[model samples]
Target: MLAEADNGAELAASMAELKAYLRIESDGEDAVLAGLLRSAAALCEQFVGQWLIRRGARETVPADGRWHRLAARPVVAIGAVAAVDDAGAVTPLPVEAYAIDIDASGDGWVRAVRPGNRLAVEYQAGMATDLNGVAEPLRQGIMRLAAEHFVARGDEGAAPPAVVSALWRPWRRMRLS
Candidate 1:
């Protein structure tokens, strides 16, 4: 399971940023705008198939006798790996036990020299955690989407704007399966 270190207390866009982007002069809708910003960020993450915010994740994967791909994208760091026995005893594996690998799109994997019944991996993954970490194009894309959402006022369906897709297209991960 993936769990954010901050429990998602930080957002890609701040309340002030959203307010400025949406051109809101009144504070009455600040709460609503904040929620909308979060919703837009989440939708953008889903659309792009990567985390836009820094999130810590712990995953327990069944060893398949080879490399194991991580569930999340843009893996920033691998914290630890451990072996879980049938009795649920966890043994922390040494750093040399596995080799970390990442693709161009930031998809990460671990090649374990000795495969076990279960392997637990702790990692951090995301494209960014704050506005500064986000690229200008992506930031603009988020703003546009949030603006669209705000204008639509929850009346529109789940479909995202074309601009959002275009901005995030380059960063999206491609599956070769």
Candidate 2:
């Protein structure tokens, strides 16, 4: 399971930026809009298979030969690796025991030179560290999605808005067969 890292960074979009995009005149619904922005950012992350802001990511994969693929994209850096004992206590694995590759393509790969039964790897992954670093397309996509969610208020639809998908298309991970 790939979970968000507890790095204490804010989401890629702020309430003021979202408010400006949405054209809300008053702060009457700031709290509600804030929640919507978070939820919308999460939905965008799921849709694109990527994190928009810096966050720690921990992935556990059973050893298969000497190499294992990290699930999250645009990995910023690898933090630590550990071997889980049968009792589930984690011992940190030495840096020499593994190798990390963050290639130009943005897909990350890790290899365990000394394979263990189950290896837990911690890393940082995201497209940007903050809102200012986020690409314009992605920021626009988040605003569009949040606005739709705010207006519709949980209405399920046949498909996502074309603009959202289009803006996120380049960042979407392509599945390999």
Candidate 3:
């Protein structure tokens, strides 16, 4: 199973930024705004197909001597790679036993020196290591989207404005089906 290990402390759009965007001056709606910001960040990630905040993740895959692509983009580092047995036991592989490669587009790839049935790889990936590192357009999109969500609170079915997509389009990863 692959799962995110950490989401980091900084949000793509901070509460203060969102509040300022919405012209909200009171703290009464802080909790609601926080949720909206998180939701907006998540939506941005989904649209871009990348993590906006740096975080760790683990994924298990068949180690068949073929390059296996990591799930997250713009991988920052590979922490560990281990072989997993049918009994669910994990044995860490030596650094020399595998190779890690990241493409120009920031996609990470891994392959074992020797073929094995399965392996688990732990790594970090994201578009930015911190909130400030995120692109301006992405941050702005998050703020705008959250503000839109706040204003349209009861209209969950409404589509996000085209500007959100426009702002995020450049960062969107294109996957060939």
TM-score of candidate 1 to 2 decimals: 0.85
The best candidate in terms of TM-score: 3
Candidate 1 per-residue lDDT, tens place, 49-140, comes to 88887888988777656887898888988888888789988889887776777777688887667776788889999877775588777777
lDDT of 3 at 24: 88
Best by lDDT: 3
In the predicted model 3, the residue pairs found to clash are none
Q: After aligning candidate 2 to the native by TM-score, how far in Å is the CA of 45 from where it should be?
A: 1.2
lDDT of 2 by residue, 103-123 (tens): 886777777777667778899
Candidate 1 CA-lDDT value: 0.76
Error of 3 at 88 (Å): 1.0
RMSD of each: 2.3, 2.5, 1.5
Please give the distance, in angstroms, between residue 177's alpha carbon in candidate 3 and its true position after superposition. 4.1
- Which regions of candidate 2 deviate over 4 angstroms? 6-9, 154-160
- What is the C-alpha lDDT profile of model 3 across 31-81, one tens digit per residue? 899888888888899899999998889999888899989988878888899
